[model samples]
Target: MPAKDKMDKTKMVTCTAPVNIAVIKYWGKRNEELILPINSSLSVTLHQDQLKTTTTVAVSRSFQDDRIWLNGKEEDIAHPRLQSCLREIRRLARKRRNDGAAGLDSTGLSHKVHICSVNNFPTAAGLASSAAGFACLVYTLAQVFGVEGELSGIARQGSGSACRSMYGGFVQWIMGNTDDGKDSLAQQVEPETHWPELQILVLVASAERKPVGSTSGMQTSVQTSCLLKHRAESVVPGRMVEMIEAVRKKDFPAFAELTMKDSNQFHATCLDTYPPIFYLNRVSQQVINLVHRYNRHYGETRVAYTFDAGPNAVIFTLRQHVSEFVHVVQHFFPPETNGGDFIKGLPVNHTALSEELKQGIGLEPMPKGVSYIISTKVGPGPCVVEDPSQHLLASDGLPKECV
Candidate 1:
């Protein structure tokens, strides 16, 4: 009788989105609230298996109010970015209904939604969690409300970097000149299959929240840093063209050079800010020095390093260079002796480090500086989880057995 009486009326959809590391960083915002960037940026979307956000959205008439749970904890649904994503999805659904699109769920449209999002990686680790987070939220919500198409523009309103995570492979976010930001959207320069051997490694320096968030930090840079203005106007345009060509040709050397330089300049602008922001520490500088020495030792650019808003190093290298370069890293920043998942994703084949190679690039070992590394490669965009059991929320519209 209980089962018969309580047939669930909830509708739900679940999806996952990968985090994007900006090779050409997006630092300053031209328009703050809309998240319009001062300069366009390019990035490689890493595989979801290693790092991503999984979100589930549920709509039910029985729910008391619209709510959300982030990593098994309740959070305010009215946070501006979250609110923007929720509002836009509903608006699109309303338009589809007014236009009489087939399979319209008018009843579900009126129901409140409960959103649950969890990341495969740590939330405040400065690994672009918000980008994947918002992208997944917008995507799953669209599926629940029966509205879809061109959601990146809406995702951009949630987080600037988020637009890039809407697609996979090599992506570029074109900073549009229009006031309404219609043209400012993400475009895939190449699909994941374009380059099979390209690999990404995340050298975790620390798993902690940044002292300053990107929004406020960049705002200070925009107002105070002249380097940022010059970089936006005179530098990024030409670099965008060169970066796109490098990806198209699979020119690792060219791509590596550009990626490293852009990352440096982005951090440079941060230092030039009035109060002066510092994202890199002693560990970061050591990693940068090691990368240069390694390339010099090989007489070519075999590896490149980029840093986001935190101290962690995101290294880009080809398959041929992976084992040796990883060997270099492990030798310099030895993992904990107690044991952990030192490498998270693809297995790193054990390779011997020759004395000739080690002494050639001479650097003092900095034990335990890096927590671990995540070995991954270019991967596809956001995806749907068709299985019912994957849902993060239950038919009762609460977190589904979350511990």
Candidate 2:
């Protein structure tokens, strides 16, 4: 093959992005295309070692069409939400090309993206898999196209909460008022370096998939739940201010109060929906009650608990208190439904677990299939990695190690 002919082959770029957990949750969207949230939300981006996705995107002449391989499996590229993100990034890259000497070669800028992503944890583990996936997708694309501008804007199209994942540590997704959703993007409140002592404990109630997805669940809540209207109109506005201040001061009690309240309200809104969607399972409820009782007994809030669109609970505690929290919760995880039988059973989700959790913490082994846990902390925003060969796609723009 001639040198020019060989150079006609496609090129690839690989990037990795971390997952994030919202302190101020984004439950609904005002604009689907732009992924404009109904209200602003706040989150703590986790360290990459704890929970993250590594995605490699490639663009090449040898590829036939846009395709995706999620965790080594081919998935249809038909979701409008996913496509909206990719489309926006491509549009921006092309716009940059129109300006001379933007540094990106015109030929490379025009290449179609073929993305392949894999999470370090189980996608079925009831964690925020999509959050990491979409965030990584947009972050990686920005690297491939060499686009200029704040990446948070691009991540918004992928997932409203994902904008926060573009940065690590403390982040806020500002709900911009513009009709185009240009100003409604994420911003860094503080870097991880500022609060290096914060800790997160994921209490995996059940590894099973969530009963309802956040997108559809939020839509149902919006249409049927009057309480949701009240939250959007009344509650979140004030809580947002409070949460920000709490983070700035490193005030755990204030942060815990606001987080617990916000989570309860979110769940309540889910219940308010007609034919009400139930995201929390019995085990989940048990966990909540246990946390509430622990706080009451301690006479102060040492830890905060929140749930996304799943039964699994994500707990936020100061690094100083993490050991105590873990010690107390560990006893609640018994290996069997009851003693001596040794038959593995799921963790008890009964409402009467207040006494059990307090007295039983660390005494029992976690019940079989009862839980999976990941301990992690706040992380930094998205970054541009220089190596394109690290991506999941091969030189030919096909997924590496596909089934």
Candidate 3:
């Protein structure tokens, strides 16, 4: 009998993964191939409703070869990282089949796959798009192949931060000490409900691609920056412990302070790199200043800001303070009046800015400095979509969006 006779006409799976913002950033790599980090890092997984990547993977014997489309455009399927994920998932499926695992789709193991993925937010603009993308790809592929258990290590091979995206709520990526990278994986510190009042606002300074990609920038930082070396060895280990504690205790001030400090140090290491990689722009600096000034005015840390490999500012604050803080952001970095809804995602109640608050901030208003804000909260990890209508690929094993 042909392989088609032993298998269903098509086996497909769809999944969505959320973007994660590292509070204790992951910078350099110990091993480039495995994408192992120099130090352990922690991040908050943003709600999928506000930001996410949806991916569909279909397997069929009729397909001649493997193919992929990203955001409605076909991409090179031979890309090395993509190959790593594909190879590993198939290898796992074969192993399980040989072991006589129940519910294994034996015939589909040899079939070709077609993958279609798209992000709700901007890609490569330092919004952790790769983290969500790779996580979703690995997850959707596993679902189709009936492979289960510990897949974060496989996701890490695609993108360093991708490992952390495997879990929900507050997660930590432990930089394991191993040559083969068998131990470097992500674990959740807390669930999405751990801190219900916690809120995240993404200030999109620019949606365009960053001047320096995180991969190249990190390679350079490892080569030249002594500060980066010092940070990896001495700094991050202690902060990881403290961050976990703060999360567990629900201590907002401690969490905010550690977050801001880590972000500052991460950027400092970038500057210490030879030829100095610059990710933050003038608008980013203004955001930083505004955050500190706003906190100082209240005599406490009400909000904190962190920037990853790009100019976008991700702010962490409490639900009680979100409305006012947003108003403050509007006052300092006025959006274009013609711009549709300056705030996106979760709704924010309108709060009038006080004259005293404005004077306390006392910064020159930079009109349209920030493109817009995405208001979201901590949420779950990769999830399967039960509805067949949501699949990105149709029954013929092709992207639905492709004409």
Candidate 4:
């Protein structure tokens, strides 16, 4: 091919983004199209090494039209949210060019794009996969187009929680009151380094898809649940303040308590909705009780559990408590049901559980309640993958591997 043709053939970028679990949940949306939340919320971005989505965006003149393949399955690119993200990114690029900021060739700017994204973890598990997915998508698209600066707003249009995944460490989605959502944006409260001892565990209660999707669930809650309105107005603002303070101070108990309370309230609002949506099941309830029992046995809050639109539990604790918590989890949700290790990802230090300690909590064993546990910690935000080997798409703009 000619040099110019080769140059226009494929320009690509790959990026990875980490999933985040809200400490003070963002349950209701004030604006569905803009994805503006009713109240500000905070979350700890989980380590990318354990839970994340890797995405590649390639724009080539030869490509016929915009397309996307998620987890190797072709998906409609015309999805309203996806279109929103694409429109915003292209608009930014066009604005920059018209303003004489910087510009890529017009053909490259207008060329169709092929996107491939895959999550290392199970998509059906309801692990806020969309948060990381959209963050990476917007980030990679911006990189390919050579546009930079605040992009959480663009990601927010794809998924409300996605905006927070744009930053690493501790982040907050400020619920701006402006009608246009111009002030509604995600901000970083602290870098990942601020809390070295803070650890996170994902307790996989059930990998199956959530019964109620967040979009419809929140819509129903907004229309039917008065408790949701109350929490959005009366509860979340205070929790956001305390959660930020607790994170900054690296106060485990304060953070843990706040995390648990907010999660419980989020679920409570779900219950309050007409024709209640149940995200938590027997296993989820058991995990909640076990966490409280373990903390009560120690007479202190060493662990906290948060659920995000699913039955799975995202546990937060400090490094010192990780080993014991894993042991406790293993004891209650025995791996014998699956005939394998209950723990995956970051290895836990072997600790002999005192029979007395296990007996003290006095909870009946719920074998196979949890499929497995992913041990991880707070980590950085979206990142560009420089290595060619990591790209999920080929030079021809086709997926390299299927998930």
Candidate 5:
């Protein structure tokens, strides 16, 4: 190959992965290195249209070493989790080549790679940014290397919940008993189209990074929180079964009840930790109260709130209730900006808050408790973006945004 051709021979792929909200949460890891959860967990993958991470990976002979840029800032490519993902993907590619898999690029395997990833949502704010980020990273790299099939296990090595983001709609991360962690993988419980009536509203209490990261939080919980151990060993198994059944049956009430209970329990375990990690702020507590009051006034579970390792509340409700629930949120947590600015993603119709409804809940308005709300629904898993313009990295193996 000519020098110019060799320089131009960049094998690149770009992909987007969705953030996921766990209903039956995964709190602790049995094997920290492998990211094997202590218990099974189920989650709903939010639509990429609302929340996603886009990643581009390019491999070329001209590149000197593995490099990475995240959200326009250069990050340490030598990070262990990153190296784990990179090593695994290369191992798979080499294995394929050894097995005489068609279209295997023998030379490209030795080339350096440039990676650029950015999230539409806030990172480390408990919105599962790492889930989408690492999922996109592993996925785009796999596509670039001509590798495919069951990449969730590899994504898990990067972030435990990342495996769940590898699939759309309802997903369950099975905590396999194997020491090698081969059986511990994500499996889709249902496709994106399975629950069209169900809608999700991410109440962004704060976009700022959480006080404690999930990795560190989970580590502490595993070591100190006996509640975490019991929940993982006892509660999660039963809830996982119920959650899966609720998702399959499209039982909103059952699903909502389980979601709220599991979320509450997850946080309780956080409190039970030796040092006690506080992920939820006053805003999160208010959201939780509002959700229950809203459901109570209706004498049923119309809405449910779940928080991860941050103050942001992820609410699940039916499409019909979205307008009213959003309005309710607005009434309680009055935004600093206009309604249009307060809500992002899918448009929500204006719904008048009735005096009866307001009086029933009777909560004092907290101005700007939530920054904004992201209205989205169940959506597909990681997807390849064929459009060259969508690539985060330029043809020269640098972040387009930075350039």
Candidate 6:
């Protein structure tokens, strides 16, 4: 006889959401339930180019149980963050149904959501995977269930930064004063079309993988790192103002300065942690030096760099400087001489593609082929796409039983 199985036996409902990158990072939280941050953070909406997660969330009575397939692999739905979002969304959904807002045509849509997410890039490689995943998950769920009212408010309960991911271009996560977190949500400051001249070049650092996850690392820092207090109180508030003004004015010099400084300070706090979590590897460090030298050599700031939970670099520059930035980053990673023997899931370093690894260690001119480069720019905020087939899960709002 076949082994017994356990899961909700029902059909499924489906939807998808894009990822986003922050200009002013969301580092810590104030309210966990409402997913409110201690301070306001801003972000540039990353274009859905090479890096993004396509999540199809489904719900239905035919489904056996709640399930998620991220990048084609089934993931445990036991994480507290995941659990909280699901519970909250479900509660809101029931309210909507009882309120008669649920569309009569789709009666089973609100019951269950089977989420299937595929990240175009490596998830563990640390390019803000959770930000994209949670944002997409929440956005898609709201759409599938026909639940309404301020989508960002719901997304916030998923992750502090996730709210910003709901929109593209310049976004602000308002640090609202509501104790219930009802007022704390993300709003679009500007659309991607407002900054067409800005360009982003992502530098893939060591594919070796991150040593510390952001959630755990942040918790550790919050508990032990004293500098974090100063950062939260004094540093970020001023930097947020300057960064916003710089974006508004398109001031490269000021933008670069604040970005690099904030990044360095964030990393410094990481070092201040008792266990000392190292997110940036030697390659990431070299890229930092390389960017510094590029700006110095040019006699002005032409580019800016920001890092998320991982060491991979997101370089911001005007369209005018993108060719120069791309040329410099691309030469850092070329194909290995063995020709096509490269491995997936393994971290790729700037030096691995470089001919001379030792000499390429510092701020020296980047060797050709040391790194892989992707060119994208800011994008717009979240919008609900009406087509159901676009969703990842079954029409019944569940993952296909086969998957």
Weakest 10 consecutive residues, lDDT, candidate 6?
339-348
lDDT of 6 by residue, 61-146 (tens): 66677888877668898778888877777777778767777353345544545678777776767677777778878876666666
Q: Which stretches of candidate 4 lie over 4 Å from their true place?
A: 1-3, 103-106, 337-340
Model 5: how far residue 321 lies from native, Å: 0.3
Instruction: List candidate 5 stretches off by more than 4 Å.
Output: 1-8
Tens digits of per-residue lDDT for model 3 on 125-207? 99999999999999999999988999999999999999999999999999999999999999999999999999999999999
Tell me which residue pairs clash in candidate 4.
none
For candidate 1, what is the total of clashing residue pairs? Answer: 0
For model 5 the TM-score comes to 0.98
Model 4 TM-score on a 0 to 1 scale: 0.97
lDDT of 1 by residue, 205-275 (tens): 98899899988999999999999999999999999999999999999999999999999999999999999
lDDT of each residue in 1-403, candidate 2, tens digit only:
9977765766666667887878788888777777788888888888887688988877775566788989888898987878888888878878877766445766765555688889986574457787788888888887777776787877777777778888888888889899998899888888898777678888767766677777788888878889988898798889889999999998889998898889888889899999798888877776787687677777778888998877878888877776556545554555333433321122222233356446643233334423445678887766656865465766666776752
Which is the leading candidate under lDDT?
3
Each prediction's TM-score versus the true structure: 0.97, 0.89, 0.98, 0.97, 0.98, 0.84
RMSD of each: 1.9, 5.1, 1.5, 1.6, 1.1, 6.1
Ranking by lDDT: 3, 5, 1, 4, 2, 6
Q: Local distance difference test, per candidate?
A: 0.91, 0.76, 0.94, 0.90, 0.93, 0.69
Q: What's the true lDDT of residue 202 in model 3?
A: 99
Residue pairs with colliding backbones in model 3 are none
For TM-score, candidate 3 versus 4, the one ahead is 3
Better of 1 and 5 by TM-score: 5
Q: 260, model 5: CA deviation in Å? A: 0.4
Tens-place lDDT per residue, model 5, 1-403, is 8977965588888999999999999989889899998999999999999899999999999899999999889999999999999999999999999999987777789889999999998888889999999999999999888887889999999999999999998999999999999999999999999999999999999989888889999999999998998898888888888888999999999999999999999999999998999999999999988988988899999999999999999999999999999999999999998887999999999999999999999899999899999999999999999999988888889998667
